[model samples]
Target: MKHSICSFVICLLVCTGSLASAQQANPKYDKKLADSLKADAYGMKMYYLVILKTGANTTENKTTTDSLFKGHMQNIGQLAKQGKLVVAGPMKKNDKNYRGIFILNSASMEEAAALLNTDPAIRHKLLDVEIYGWYGSAALPMYLPYHEKVEKNQ
Candidate 1:
């Protein structure tokens, strides 16, 4: 009898918990806004993912590499400012040929390649790039603003 009562109480709690959560509205939920942004559906779209790999000259020259990397950062900022790049970051502590990645706003591989070529690191052959078309949330473009809010030191 005691076990039966405990099981009943547990089931009641679980069902009520699920019901309460289902009734709660997400803070950012707005149907009109979503429709206005053309994200009413699954909000999936094609984007280019550029993978940066260790180049032939990646670590061959430290001084030149430092300068090229500085220019690379500048290029990243420029692309972000132009809304051409959705996200970019370097991989940490990896021994493989992997270096970094860029999620580009472009749908065309040619365009992505052209934009990537603008980087001094790429231009000077300090980094090699491979691009692929990816389908993901159209809401991804909205992430950067919210990301800036919680970022401490940029």
Candidate 2:
């Protein structure tokens, strides 16, 4: 009798837990926002992921290197404003020779390559790059606006 009573209690608790989880799983879906972001059923989309690496250019000319990097930052800002570059940032010191990364909202590898060529640092070989097709959240582009607000210097 005791074993049967324990089994019944365990079954009741399991059913109650399932009911609570099902209730919390139902969230309000925003179809308009999803459509605007071009999100799939899983709220994801395709993008170009560019990994920046240390280039072979070890020129000692600080002025030339500075100019190239200045142009690089300018190009990054321009692309972000145009909604082409979704995310970009540098990496901490590492052994793998990685320099930085860029997530580009480009339709094809050719388009992404063309965009990278616009950066003087990349064009001059101060920074080499490897690009791959990436599947990520469609709302990744929306973070730029929030980033701007949080940036105190800009």
Candidate 3:
């Protein structure tokens, strides 16, 4: 029984030591990391979250629809390039009125409204937008570069 206890203690120590080593600070955890993470600022910043709902005008003209969609994508790219848009994507499920979402970089509702106005989908009345101010991580601006690196397709 004494021999078994000693062996168990030894095994526990070895496992804990390995675990502690694995939890050590990463080598690249430095001032740059803190700055990149915006750790010095407040925990959250104000942004606008726009929920796109299906508009009243849903008449299907394939060519017009395609053109508007292409223009919508172009507008999204442009907004992202200008840093006005943090993230935007469509919802997969169509059961609800909720269509897609846009996370805008502005704290002002008017600014978000102006940005949404530029989207062809919204302009053409293919999609109606509802904007709400959101408080979220200030680290969101840092996600784009990482997204670009990991994305397999365009």
Q: Best-fitting candidate, measured by TM-score? A: 2
lDDT of 3 by residue, 1-154 (tens): 9999999999999999999887666556455656654554454678899999988778959999999989999999999998889989999868767789999987489989999999998999988988999888777877887888998988
Which candidate leads in lDDT?
A: 2
List per-prediction Cα lDDT, in the order shown.
Answer: 0.84, 0.92, 0.85
Alpha-carbon deviation at 36 in model 3, angstroms: 9.8
Location of the lowest summed lDDT over 10 successive residues in candidate 3: 35-44
RMSD, model 2, all Cα superposed? 6.2
Q: What value does the lDDT take at residue 124 in candidate 1?
A: 85
Tell how far residue 114 is off in model 2, in angstroms. Answer: 1.1
Worst 10 residues of 1 by lDDT: 35-44
Error of 2 at 67 (Å): 0.3
Q: Candidate 2 residues 3-106, lDDT tens each?
A: 99999999999999999886543276678998988888788998999999998888739999999999999999999999999999999999989999999998
Model 3: pairs clashing at backbone N, Cα or C within 3 Å: none
Higher-ranked by TM-score: 1 or 3: 3
Which stretches in model 3 have alpha-carbon errors above 4 Å? 1-41
Candidate 1 whole-model C-alpha lDDT, 0 to 1: 0.84
The superposed Cα distance between candidate 3 and the true structure at residue 6, in angstroms, equals: 58
Evaluated at residue 110, the lDDT of candidate 2 is: 97
Error of 1 at 28 (Å): 10
Using TM-score as the measure, what is the rank order of every candidate, best first? 2, 3, 1
